[model samples]
Structure formats: structure tokens, C-alpha cells
Target chain A: MNTRFILVLLFLFLFMPCPSQAEMGMGISGRTEALVIEQFPYVYEGRFSIHNTSDTACLYVLAVASPYEDVTEWVAVSPAAVEIASNGYADIKYTIAAPGGYTGDYDIRIIANGYALSGEGTTGDRPVSYLQTSGSLRISVNVTHNAGDASLGTTRPHEADAPAAEDPQPVDVGSQAYLDVPTDVSVGTAVRLRGGIIGHEAPASLCIVLSSPMGESYALPTDYTYTFREEGVWTARLTLPDAPLVERQIRVRPVRAAGMAGGAYAVAGGLLLLGFLALHRERKKGQKRREKSEARHQTTLSSISLKSKTLEGREMPKGL
Target chain B: MYQKTRITALIAILALLTIPFVWADSESVSATAGINPYAPSFEYVEITDTELSISSHLDVDREYYLHVHSIDKNGITDIASLVCTLFFAGDGSLSAGATDTRSCYTLTYTYANGTANWTSAPAGHLVEGDCSATPDGYRSRFIFAFSLGKIAIPSGDTNTWKVSVTIMDRSGQTTTYADLPFDVNDYIEWSGVPSTLELSSTCMDPESPWTLPQSQPVQAVVTSNVPVSVLFCGADLMYGADAIACETFTLETVATPAGGTVNTAYAIPGAIPTESVTLVDTAYGTACMLDPTLAGYCNNSAGIASFVIDAATGATVPYVPAGTYSAVWTFTLERGAGVTP
Candidate 1:
């Protein structure tokens, strides 16, 4: 009888409604696990079809997880998180471009994390007290860096290492212009807009210009000098005759006021403390002098006050 | 007198025969058209807006939806066909059939309208929209319902879906229009893995003695499908005095939410917030980046929230007893407008 009842319980559990039986909240439709890119300054295009096998709508977020920081800079994907209807799917488009100088093969794994929250908005009651983030889908990207190819494209300015374009439009551009100027500086101060052009050079003259809405303007020379006569948002451009190779926005701030608004109160508090200390010291000094005089008079004329009067070289003092 | 009456009867019969032809070719948003059908029966102007919705599906369905509004329904009688083309757009625009359009969207088609059933679009094709115009509105302001499902999607295709509804008038003049830029994807991955939350003394810089160590905030990337807010389940996870009070925990924005309607009422502003004490003790947990874009999976620049737990309690992180702390979290789905799994 006991055995029969146990078997019946097992049967019921097996057929019970199990939401977990479906495909996990999120899944990748593509069969392949690895992605291969042919060249350096390499630009790779691929797709990730996220399938929501569960009965509920799910959200998935993609993030790059690799030891190499360069891999993160190489990839660009659109629409951060996707919410697909039950059994429905959506595609994730990605563009991967490696820098110019990198060579050899490196492994990169991009993770797609799925989320479904139990709590409603800011006002609703939640089943749990906090949000738990888990469940991930990964794509192992294997990038091979051979020689340079203008066709492959790059994620960053290749001038530091490689070039991306062919001519005016070249892939893996090896030429780069860098500006080493601070973003905020005061007026009347000479701010040297220090920068350089690296990698391949254009056939035209390299120059830098500071432009602002105000009348202040400067087409910099080899010294890279710029004297800010006014305060405003200034645009710094590194131009190579035809186009501005690199541009940096700087805030030229006017000199600050003499004293700080908030700090002034603290300064006043310190001054009051010093005045109290000085007054206290003076009182103590006066008390000591009177005490000394009192002790001396106590041995002679006890009735005499500390204040004494001397006339014709004769000191006179009594009860009066 | 008998001859005159007979002539009038003959003229009446002739007039009736020509009137039916003129009425059949009447041109108006509500009228039947085209005794002479033009090159295109329908005129297309510009797209107003689109949203991904479930109301578009009739019998079976698609993911993205285009609610097409025609300024004038004139000359258009019936929806001829829906051509869902999938292609590798090397160029940016998803034109009707540019030189670079790939041919794999629909393998078998009779190339005509209605009584037609697709064998089902192949796997990677992005769209197969079903849109039809009804005479419910006034002559010039008819709303044509356009529905798109993901029967097809090509890889690395961004904004490559061009869902044009083929509209025809009574005279059989046809026109097709609607370019839908949806960020749908099959291949996807995150820009980075969940960052390691390191709040111990090791993270502290030895060179700077006074500086405290701050752990990055734990975050949830909110979706646009609904008004989303993060619920820190074990509020006790912070207040429990196992070792250190979780008050030093902070919310950080790793990426900004793309095109999300800021719920000015639902969230606290600022890209990064420094309110750990108020969050730990308060009823509402700390909100990461609350950009609910009514949501996509892989755009790194799109917007991601990083929830950090820093050991830096103000200028100095309180001393914590050395030990390993672990937590098991279950990420569930918040389905519907604001419904949860």
C-alpha cells in the first residue's frame, strides 16, 4: 500500500507544471560558438539572434568580457537590451574593428545577460526584496591579426599604430594627430595647445585653431600658443589644410573671486576663536599681577588696596 | 408626334450605357478609381512613427509594427501584396531593392496579392509585414495597419528592414511605401561581463593612505517595454550587520540609456548617484540607471547601468572583517507593461 502511494506521488510530480522545463529565459539561435576575423585593424560584422523560449517576455543585455581592454574598444553593438515576446526572437548587430598595430590571435567573449524582474515599478510590492541578475549567453570571438588591410576597417584612430582607409578615405589609417591641452584654463594665461601628428602624414600643412563664439580666435603656430582674452566654450581643432584631423573642446574659464563663499564662514569662526584666546590670556596676565601685589601688601598693610598713590617720593596708603 | 417620341426613347437608352463606366472610374479617397490606372495608384509621402506591438498579428504574427497613415486614400482600393525583402545592406539605406539587397527573404511566392500563404520565410530573414488599408476613416485620412514579424533577418544588418505595403486602387494602379529601422538581432553578446565587485582593502591604493576603496555599483539595465525600477531583494543584504553595513554601496551608470523616455517621476536624476546611506535605510532600493526605453540587447553605447558597492564610506571605508561573502540571485522576467514573472 505504501509503495503504491509513493509511486502515485512521483507520477504527479513528473507531470506538474514546471516553467523551468522550457528553454531558459534566453538563448542564442546561431549554432557556431567561435568567430574568426582575417586581418588587423580588422572590422568584423556579425549577428546574434536571441530567442525567448519561455512563456514570458524577457530582456537581454550584451557586454564584452575579455582580459584584453583592446577588444572592448574594438566592438560596437546597437540597442543595449532587447525585450522579446514569448517564443519570439530579435537580432543583435555588431561591428568589431581592431586597432592597426595589433597582431597575433586573442580570445574575446561577449556575454548576453537575460533579465526578468519580479518587482513592478517604484511603487509595487516585490516578491523578493532586491533584484538578482544572472543567466548569461556567451560568444567566443577569436581575432587573428595578420598584416594590414585597408578593407578590414578599424575601431580607433590607426595613426597611433595603423591606418584604416586608403587615401582621404583609408582603412587602418596610421596617421594620427594628438592634442595635449588642458580643458579648463584662465584668461590672460598663455595656454600652449601642445599636440602632434603621428603615423602617415598628409601632403598639406598641419595647423591647429581655437574657435569660440566670442571674438577670441587663434590659428596656432609651431609654438602652439593661445591667449584667452575672454571666457567661454572654445573649440580646438587640429586641421591638416583640408580637414580638421582632430578636435578638442575646451572651457576657457575666467579667474576665480578672491575668497570662497562657503569657506568664508569657516574663516570667520577661526578669527572668533583667536580673539577669545587673546582676551583670555590678557585677563590671566592682569589677575596674576594683582595677585602678586595683594600678596606683598598682605604682609605689610593688610587694609591697603592694590591701587597705591605716591606723592613727594612718600608712598601713602591706609584703609581710606 | 409618334416619330418624335420614338427618337427621345433612343437617346435615353444611350445615356444609361455611358453612365455606368463613368461611375466605376470615380476618383476620391472613398471612390473606385482608374478608368486609366496611373504608373502608381497610391502616393507615398513620409513615415510618421512606428512601434513594436502585438495588436498587428492576425491569426499568426510578427515582431515590429508600422501603423501607416495615408494622407489620402484616394484611388487606392485594395492592398495588393506585402513584399518583405531581406538583404545585406553594405550601404546604410534599406531602399526597395537596391543593388546590394540579398534575395533570401521569401523563397516561394506567386508574386500577387491575397489567398496567398508563405511556406514561411527562411531563418535569417528580418521581416515579413502584413498591412492592409480599411475605409474606416474619412476620404483623405485613412489609417492603414502594418504588422511585421521576424520571419527573416540578415546578419550584421542594422536598420535594414524596409516594410513597404503594396497598395492598389480599383483601376489596379499600385504603390508601395514604409521603411522601418528596428534593432532586431539573432547573434548577440555583452560588451563586458558583470564586473567583479571588489570592496576589500586590496582594491585600496597603498600610495594614497587617506583614500578609501570604492566598489562599483550593481546595476540593472531597464527596458522601455514598461516603467521599470530595480528592487534590491534582500534589503537585509545591506542592513544585516554580518560585518560592515552596506551603506557604502552606490549606483553607477556604465552606459547611458539610449532614447529612453526619462521617467522624471519614477527615478532620481544624475548619471551617477552617491546616496548609499539613504538607500540602505529607506524602503525603496537604490535605482541604477532608470532609462526604460519601452528596450535591444547589444548596443554597448545604448545604455547600461553599473551598480557598485564601494568600500569608500565617504572619504574612508569602514574597516571590514576579512571574510568571503557570497550571494545567489535569480533574474526573472518583468513581462507585460509592468507585470512581473
Candidate 2:
């Protein structure tokens, strides 16, 4: 029975939360973990979270410090002393004033020193002893001048270079396919779309669905070329409308081109066809008039031959 | 029961180790201190009151002033004496082979009600003093005038000087303040004809279109003390009054009879009368001549550029007011073709 009791107590010690373990430590966190400031003759205001991680009430002294002596001289901390309740947190404020005509990098750190109150109900001016569980947290602040060049190390790469998502799993849309389309296009300009089936077999039919900036979708013919009249960000999607396959969408930015409008080409083509039809009709009318003239001459020759034959018969009777 | 007692002892030891110990208490004073501000600052003023000319030589006989005073703040606490020293750098030699050097001069002034006594010291040495008297008011002002000849500066050398003023209080606290840079040089000389050009009001009329004079002869002769590879000469039209109506003017170098060349005319599209405008910039013009030897200098005579007022408006607005508009024509002589001396 004693052994069993010891085993049960050990299990309870392992599972139960210990109050003494929670009562003896301090912690500090910053609202602004890192700062990037530009320009001089400027002021920066920051706040930090200071908590008594221990279970007992504690007194804390907050101070603004820096590795750079010049920065330390310019930084000011408010509410330098505070009393935090057990397992409670407090916020401290700090201000940094940068002098004019000085351009360089400045790193600042905010330090909170935790101590044990010497007496109960201790308020201001209470002597405190340093705590063994005191903690130090550092919040890095970077300050620079506007006229100076910004450090390029903090910049991120362009989002366009990110790898494209893998092709969606094939659905019931006939055979799988992929699309090859330009990511950039100009408004009122013709763009070509080229794609083929995933395998050697060609799909029964393939079409393109264009989603415009106005949230409108268009079902375009299978023609490889298309011209967008509107100017904005558009998404060109290649899909098999008859088949149940996933469609591929590509982003495009359409810009307005100079000179003739898209409709101008259609109008010019219509005018050329109209001119050719008019010329062909005029030539057909000239040929019909020539055939009529030839028939009339042939009739005239036949009438002359008939009259000559009658005159010769009359002249032969008179001579007998 | 024995095992439980041992576990309890182990837990107590761990708790004791985690808790911080408090030593014997003793009575002590706990005081909080704040930052203290102390110091008496003053502003400095140059006594010459004129813009320093780079080309004109400084005359050693003329007295120059260095004034320091505090109008807002009180003077140094219980001031006993104020000593002023002027330091000269790059003033030593202009010889073709001499190395540059620096030197300093000191002059101590004794405190009085409104006046002070000056005691000059040898060059490169400081003169120390402790006058018993003090100024009547809390605000203090000191003016020191000294001649450049006393500094032993070599001829034809360019010199830069700065002044440091030190104040000693009764408690022996000494604070020194340094002034801005002041330059003095002796290099180039130039002279112009007609000393001054007066453009009559009749030449500037709203009713009649105006043109520059073609016959009135005006010229300038520029000479340099040292050899220069190229020479740049121009004139700035300094107006006497603020413009009321128009803001356009033109000046052209029409003729150069003394082997000088003329380039495109200088035109001011929108000029402010209160500010000076360059009527001619010969630096980039045909007037600039190259000397391959780098030993030749500018000693040639160039014609004075002609001026036409309110011509750039192109009949868009009325000519400048009928008042007798006066302008000062100041000529500039630079060393290189496009460089300012």
C-alpha cells in the first residue's frame, strides 16, 4: 500500500501545476519588436510589456539604454519605477529624440530590472532587493536619416518569381491540359494563347474564358488571338467548356495603345470589301452589254439575207 | 514515512535555492536625482558686415570685428575676465615652393562698466589676465577689432581664421565657444569702363518696344596675379528696387575688339528684381580660351554686355514701371572656364 501511494503521488506531482514554479520569475515583451526610423530631428515613441512572471508582487525599475553613448544621451524613459501585482503586466513608454545634422545608425534597448519589495504594501520610495529570477529582454530599434541610402538587406524579392502552384488534380473534364499565355498584355491589342493537351491526344474542343476587371466573364471562340478593349488587370483562363477539367488562369495587365482604336481595323476591312464588290458589279454590267450588242448584229445579218433572196426571185420572173 | 520525509526535505532545499536571500539591513539614505542644465551660450557676429569676396585681396590696415554676446541668457556667473583668441590656419606661405602652415594670436580684454582695455600678445602665444572689474548688467557683449597685418601672414596666401572666446567666472569655471569659418584672400583684380551704366527710363517704355544700344562702348579689363589655365568673366545685374510688373531681361556680348570672343546671349526669362541676375556667363561661351601651357593668365579686355529690359515677355505684358529703375553691374573674374574662384 505504501508503494502504491508513492506511485500515485509521483503521478500527481508530474501532472499538477506548481504555484512556486510560477512565482519567481520576470518577463518582458515589446509591442514593436523592431523599428526602422528615417530622418533626424525626429521623435520616436514606443511601448513595452513588462510582467512579473512570478507569483509574488514585485517592484521594477525601467530604463532606456543603448550600446551607443550618444544614443543613450538622447533617449528618455517615463514612469521609471513601477509596482506590479503578482502575475501581472505593465506597459512602459519611452521616447528617443534624434538631433539634427547627425546621420548614422542607432540601436536602442529597453531594460526592465525586477526586484523583490522589502516590505508589504510598499509603494513609492520603498527599498527593494534584487531578484534572482530577474529577466532582461532586448527590443532592437534602428534609426536612420531620410537623406541617407536605405539598407537593401531588408528588402524582399519580387513576388512574381515565386514558384507557381502545381497543376490541380485532374477532374472529369475530358483529358488534362496546360496553358501557355503571356502574363502581360496591352488593352486594344491582340494577344495569342497557345496550349495543348497534357498527353499526345488532343482534346475534342478547347476554349478560353476571360475574367475582366469588372467581374465579368466572357466565353471566347477557340481562335488563338484575342484583343481586350478595356484597360485594367485581367485574368485569362484556358478551359474546356465541354469537358470537366480544371482551368489555368494567368494574370495580365492591359494598357492602352496609341493611335487607331480596335474597331478601326474592322471598319477599314469593311470599306475595302465594299469597294471590291462595287468594282466587280460594274464589270459584270459591261460584259452583259457586249453580249447584247453581238446578238443584235447577228439578227441584222439574217434579215439582210432574207431580203436579198426575195428580190432575186422577183427579178427572175420578170426576165422570163 | 521515511521516504516522504526525505522528499519533503528535498523540496524545501529546492525552494530555498530559488528564493533570493536578504542580508542584514542597515539604515541608508535613498535619494533620486534628475538632470541639471547649466551653461551660458552666446551668438557670434562678423564685424566687417560685408560678404567676403574670394578674388579681392584683404587689406591688412583695415580693422575687422568679431562680436559675441548673449541677449537671451545671463552672462557667465560672477565673470572675472573674458579672453578672446583668433586662430589662423593655412595662412603661412604663397611661395612657389613653401609648405603651408598655421598660427594663432591672442588679445585679452579687462572688464569695465561699458569699456574694456586691450592687451596684445606676440603671434602664436596666448595672453592670460584676470581683471577685477565686471559689467554693469547680466547680459554681456564683447567686440574685438584687430588688423590682419599684425598676424605675420605671407603675401599672396589665402588664410582662414576662426575666433574662440573664453569666459572665467569668479569660481574659476572657464567655458570656451568657437565661431564659424572666415576666409580672406588676395588673388585677382578687375576694372570696368563707365564705372556704372544707367539705363534711362526712356529706354524702358510700355508703349515703345526697346532694343539694346549698339554704339555706346563699355568694356572691362581683367588681370590675374597668378597663372590660370582658363578664365571666366561675367556681370551680375543688381537691381535697386523690387519689380512691379515685368520679370524678363536680356544681355548680350555684342562685340569683343580685344581678341575676345562672343557666345550666345544671356537671357533671364523670369527674374526677381530684389535678387541679382547674371546678365552674361562667358564660362561656357566662346569667350573662354584654352591655354595648353597652363602658364598663361587672363589680362585681356572684353566688351561690356548690353542689357534689354522686359524683352522676354514678347508683347504679353506691359513693360516695367516708368520709374527710373537703377541697377548695379558688378563684374566677376574666375580662374577656370566653368569654375568659380
Candidate 3:
């Protein structure tokens, strides 16, 4: 038995290079080479590359841990980490817990182990990692703090804007301003408004919110009011309402509107009167000229007939 | 008399209203009936043939000239400008050159097997050809060689081209030559790298901020005249204890995000890496979600995620498998500490 054992030992020594080759042959590299974590005061995760370097195929196991104590209070344990495989390499991913008040620098590292197993009767070779020769991967963590706040304030300019503000009734002392009709009425018969206009030319329209005393409300047409350019000349006129309103207690607000009927009538009457007087005056002058011409013609004709009669009488006496 | 007087007054009023009396009579007359509407017309060439045939091994250091001339509706012959593009077929190669002549181009070639030649020269007479060998099809192709000065076109300009030869017959007939085939690749050299980039990530969140870790950064840069956008980046993550989670960050090619903005991403289909690596530790009942503040975590969720293709590059650098992973991944997208939600 001793002689056979010696012979076996010699054989083993001669072919021992195969085992070394197999050990170096089986290996794997992680697929991912980079990661970005951006949650502040929260847990961050990263992945490491695992490459298979040995000739014999083998499974890989990966582990991650905190390389720095001061940077983080919590460390990444077993369940929180993951290992994956592709092409001969496995990836070991690590997640760090959220350190709410944590700031500054911290190092994260990942370690991978590769192993090859054979036979049903015997266990496999012990798993090993390329940590020492291949070197471990480390990541830099930067925790930032929040600064102060900056804001913008409201300082807007104020010009003239009606309706947005309260709509107040304009007051005039002397000139009459048109007031909106209390009741709605059709065209032809003008309903009088009670407000006064302070300018000479009436404006086109004004806005009035009218509501029925019974709770019903309607926005009066803004086109119903008129505006005047001149200052301090107030006047009011009756207006033709668009439609008839059944309610008598309709709330009416005075708004400026153009004079509807009075100015039009005055203009028409003045033009008609001036035209008639001029025509009559022209006809009279024509008649006087005709009369003078007729009188002159009659005078001339009478003088000629009288001379002819005198001549005839003188001739008759001479013949006798 | 009264009627005539009234008539005269009515006519005067009508004439006053109709005539533009404010303008001088000479100016008004000239403005109203100035030009003759039935004027003589002329014709022009609208389009040109976009195809050409040259030697695949053609030397790009030399100049090549192509000429095209068209006849108008009145049978007046006029020169036409042809803008052509040259491409290679098998091992695709392209090169472009400059020329000194009115209708010639000096071809520069960078790609090996084939050549592409075109001109950026002034307009000149275009050579017209009849491809009667081919039928009345959209494909019109012909091969011709002419020497103006010492510009010699090699013999094998046949196989690698699709020429679009338009002919303006002497009778003022305009025809379009489309999809013509060619024998050789005209040599042209294009310098400088691509001007765009494509960026992709397995997991991403728009609401959360993102940062690339110094260790696993997915960055490809172009140092020279080449634009970085032409570069493509792809990433994969293995799920489980070391669950794979990767984020790809790409710089916006455009200077501003809101101005003449450029797109910077392309989403690759079925290329997302989302497997979970886990220890299956049922005994320890701890459900650890991916930390938003962690590096490489696309999200705290447990599914495989892939990034869309970057608008800049068309490459997917690292690709991973897809599935629900048992492993936990933590990513932290924390903004400033006091950042409001």
C-alpha cells in the first residue's frame, strides 16, 4: 500500500497544473459598471461588475457592506442586497438605508465569490472571489443640505378698471343723466332713466346689473349706456327698451346712454324750416321780376296803338 | 329745360363720387390700366435626377464633373443644377469632396470598399441621356462618361449606382428619371463624427433627481470634432441580493432646455434589465424597498426597468433581462434637504 500511495502522489504532482488552471478559469463579471443615486437623506443603491475568470463554469455569490462608519449609521445587510448572473459574471447590487441627518462622504463596496462543484458524493470546491487581485469597487456618497428660501411679493400697479371694483352710480349736479328704466319695454315709446349726464356729448353705453325685486336678475346690455366726452354737463333722455318686463319693481341703475329722440327731431326740424324759407324767398323774387317786365311791355304797346289811331283820324278828315 | 338741368346736376354728383379726384389724372390713369395682362411666358427646370454611377474603387483625391441642361417650353435650352447623394451597397462607405471647376467636385473618401462622389460646384450644362433599354418604369438608369479637361472617369462605373436621369427633349418635353440603378459607389469622404447621442437607463424617475455614481457612471464623450450625441449607451441590472439597478445620465446637446431644444433620449424595446437578486429570507420579515437616495436604483419598485433610447445616440451599451426580481434595490432621488414635494 505504501508503494502504491507513493506512485499516486507522484501522479498527482505531475498533473497538478490542471487544477490550478481550473481554479483560475471559472469566473464572472458584473454587467453594470455605473450607477446614480439621488435621494437626499435616503437609502441609495448601486451595482458591481462580476466576471468569470476560471475555465470551469461555476455559480457566483455577491455581498455588499459599508466601507465607512462615519458617513452612514446603517449598513446594507443580506436581504437588502441582490446577486444576478449573465455571460460568466454575476452582479452584486447593494442598497443603503436612508440616513435622514447624514451628510458628507461615505464609501460603498461590493465583494463577489465564484465556486465550482463536482459529483453527487462529494461537495464542491470552496467559493472564492477575485477581490484581492481584481480589487474591490468603492463609491463616493455626497449628502447635501437645504438652504434658505426666496420668494416674490405682490407689488402691482393700479390704473383705472371698472366692474372689477365696485360699480358705483355716477353723480352729476346740473346736467341730467339717463337712468336705466325700471320696467322693460319695447321700442317706440321711450322709457325715461333717472340719472344725469355731466357732459355735452352722450357716451355710447354704460353697464348696469338689474334684478327683479322678486329675486330674478339680468345683466343689462352694456351697449344700452352712452358716454360723453365733455365734463360737468349733465343731461338725461328717454330710451327705447329692448323688451317688456312684467315686474314693476325692477331695480334700475343710472348709466350714461346717447340721447335717443330729442336731438334727432331738432336737427330734422331745423333743416326742413330752413329749406322752406329759402324756397319761398326765391319764388317771391322771381315773381317780382316777371311783374315789372309785363308792365313795361303793356306801356309800350299802348303808346304805339294811340299813335296809330291819331294818324287814322287825321287821314279821315282830309278825305272828307 | 328743368329736366335737363336736374339731369346735369345728378350726373355731376355721380361723377364726383365715382372719380378718385384727389389723385392726379396722369397717376390715376397709369395706375388703373397700366400693364398688359396677356404677357409672353418662359419655362424653367423644376427638378433633377438624384442618382449617379461611378467606380467603387474610384480615387477621391481627383475631381469629377457632371453636367445637366434642360429645354424650356419655347424650346430654349437652359442649364440645370443637380444635387445628388452617393451611397455604398455591400460594405457601406461614404466620402464627399470639393471641386474647383464650375461643375466639378473633388471627392474625399474615408470608408473603404465603395466610393460616393457629388459636386458642390456652380450650375452648368446637364448631359441628357435616353435609357431606352429600360421600360416605362419608375426606375430610370443610364451610364455615360465625358471628359472636360483632364478629368478621366474610370471604365467600371456600371454596377453600384441608381441614377435618376431626367431628359428635356428638344421639343420642350420634361421627364423625371426615378430610382435608377448604378454599378459602382462614387467615392466621397465625410469628416467629423456624428452630431448626436443616445442615452438609455434601466430605471428612471422624472419627478426625482438623478446622479451618476463615480464607480458605475455611464458616460461616453467625444473629445474632437466628433459630436457626442452619435454615441449610444445601454445598461442592465441583475436582480437579487445585489439587485441590478442602473441609471444612465446624458448631457443635453442643446445649450438650453426651453429654447431651440433638442431631444436626448431613445427608448430601446425589450432591453431593460429588471431581475431581482434576493436571499429569500422568509425568517427575517423585513421588506426593504429601494432607497430613492441610493445610487443606481431606477426606483424603489421591484420590476425590471429599461430606459428609452437617448435622442442623441442609437446605442444600448449594457442590456439586462426583464422579470420580477426577488432581490431588493434601493435608490434615493433626494433633492435639497428642504425641497418641497
Candidate 2 deviant stretches above 4 angstroms: A1-320, B1-39, B49-58, B71-77, B91-102, B112-115, B123-137, B150-159, B187-341
State candidate 3's DockQ: 0.00
User: Cα deviation in Å at residue B102, candidate 1?
Assistant: 17
lDDT of 2 by residue, A1-320 (tens): 45754664565455443222112334443332344556555577755555554455655555454544454656666666567776566667777775642334444445444433321111111111111222223345565545233433232344552223221111222222333344445666776654444322345466667787789998665337777776666655445543322233333443433333334454555565466557667777878888888888788887788788777666565456
Residues B18-68, candidate 3, lDDT per residue (tens digit)? Answer: 777655566556645574322112222112222343322322222233323
lDDT of 3 at A35: 26
Per DockQ, the best of the predicted structures is 1
lDDT of each: 0.39, 0.42, 0.28
Cα deviation at A22, candidate 3, in Å, is: 2.7
Instruction: Pick out the ten consecutive residues of candidate 2 chain B with the lowest summed lDDT.
Output: B93-102
Q: Candidate 1: count the clashes.
A: 72
Report, for all candidates in order, the number of backbone clashes: 72, 5, 155
Question: List-wise, what DockQ does each model earn?
Answer: 0.05, 0.00, 0.00
Mind giving the per-residue lDDT tens digits that candidate 1 earns over B1-341? 89989999988888899888777764732646566434333333322223533321111122333344433344223333334443322234434443121212332222244443332254322233433334434322223332223222322222233344444444455455544333333221122223123333444332222323344445543322211222121122221123232333333323334322322321432222211111211111111122112122222223343334433545343444332322212232211111110
Q: Which stretches of candidate 1 lie over 4 Å from their true place?
A: A1-24, A27-62, A66-97, A104-107, A119-320, B1-39, B42-62, B66-166, B172-341
